[model samples]
Target: LDQIILNLVSNARDAIEDNGRIDIKVSTGSSEDILEHNSIVKPNADKYCLLTVSDNGSGIDEEKLDKIFEPFFTTKSAGTGTGLGLATIYGIVKQNNGYIFCESKKGRGTTFYIYFPESDEKPSEKQLIGKETKPDEQVSSTDKKILLCEDDEGVRNVLSKMLGAAGFNIIEAADGEEGLRKFKENKDDIFCVVSDYVIPFKNGIELYEDITSMSPDMGFILVSGYSHDVDNIAELNENRNFSFLKKPLKPELLKRTIMDIAKHGND
Candidate 1:
């Protein structure tokens, strides 16, 4: 929710000229209201927390509205926007069983209405991330060390926390080269190599190939943020020693997967 709100606020800010105002309001609503307000043609569930962001800025046009949710669609000048902001936000909201609606006119202003379903049940791993550990994942095993290779420091820190909480011992590196070096230095100790698909010095496949040459049955997991990079959720490897996870890595899947390595062995 924080992420979605921030992106919307940022968009609102970008839309504004001079000192235009942006308003954010959160209120409870029923599904009937969602339909009546045209916030959603038909919301799937009953209760909702409606988020409305309004900007008194240069409003979007009717022609552009249809394409706003499309990936890489932007009205801002080149270098001012990446065009992935709304697309990513749309993905996140819909994935969590929510709805998004927009109201705009060329000269007036633009407002976005987001309807997030309210649930008493705890969020699933696919919903809100970083829920409590699974029953089986509660057991800690420090011996199952992981070579975590990610270029971004912020992502690495967050992932390190999740890995530690999930009970795996960590060996970190900034990029594929450093990751390979760490893997070599601790070859015997490192049971699994979890690497970012795109990184400096060497790519993930190259790193995997290099390590696998030395340790053919090395447990490997290729991690990537882009959805297109991983086509074979089919299986990370035919031998069951390889796997993959998309980023903004969810806690439960990460724990379950790393633990799978321990239970199944390096193979």
Candidate 2:
């Protein structure tokens, strides 16, 4: 939700040439009310929440509305945006058993509606923990094999070489389907699966499920350009001890995540 809000705000800021209006409305309701009003299923039956962010700026063209959520589909200039923000948000919302809808008109405005399942449990407050600054120089000798799944050829090659140079044998897969095949074939030899969240055929989460079902101890790291709802990722991380690395990834962050998982074995 934080990421989604940030992306919307940033996009709105970019769209506005001088001054514009951004309206943020948050509401809580029951499944029945949501269904009655919105004509959409409440993400969860017991309770539900709705968050809407609307921006009065340069709106999207009608033609691009359907493609906005497609991965790598962006209207922004190269290097300005990854085009992954909306897609990532869609994936995150879907993963969390939620639904997202966007309404926009060229020159009019844009609005995004996000519906989340609710619970009686209180929301947990989180404390900010600064990143570890002290580096652990202890080199790992674990000859663990990793399944590297990435759609981008350049990213895949770079990560494969880096992991290989780190004394870890890597099985490279171009997309999610191939990754799943390789993982199933080398289930015993594979120690972990590092995958891009957006891939051809299937996605990282789908692959994670397939691999983990076969090898209960199998580890996963999801690399993506952006995210919509980090809470969904947090829930997964807490439950499965999986890790996520945001894109435009730094080599250091990747190495740290790998080393942490390799050393502690997901706690």
Per-residue alpha-carbon lDDT of model 1 for 87-157, expressed as tens digits? 88899989988888788998778999888988779767766665566776454477778898888665677
How accurate locally, in lDDT, is each candidate?
0.80, 0.77
- Residue 179 C-alpha lDDT in model 2: 94
Candidate 1, clashing residue pairs?
Answer: none
After superposition, the stretches of candidate 2 with alpha carbons farther than 4 Å from their true spots are 1-139, 229-231
Q: TM-scores of all models? A: 0.61, 0.49
What would the TM-score be for candidate 1 when compared with the true structure?
0.61
Query: Cα RMSD (Å) between model 1 and the true structure?
Result: 7.0
Candidate 2 — which pairs collide? 1-229
Q: Distance from true position, residue 210, model 2, in Å?
A: 1.2
Worst 10 residues of 2 by lDDT: 123-132
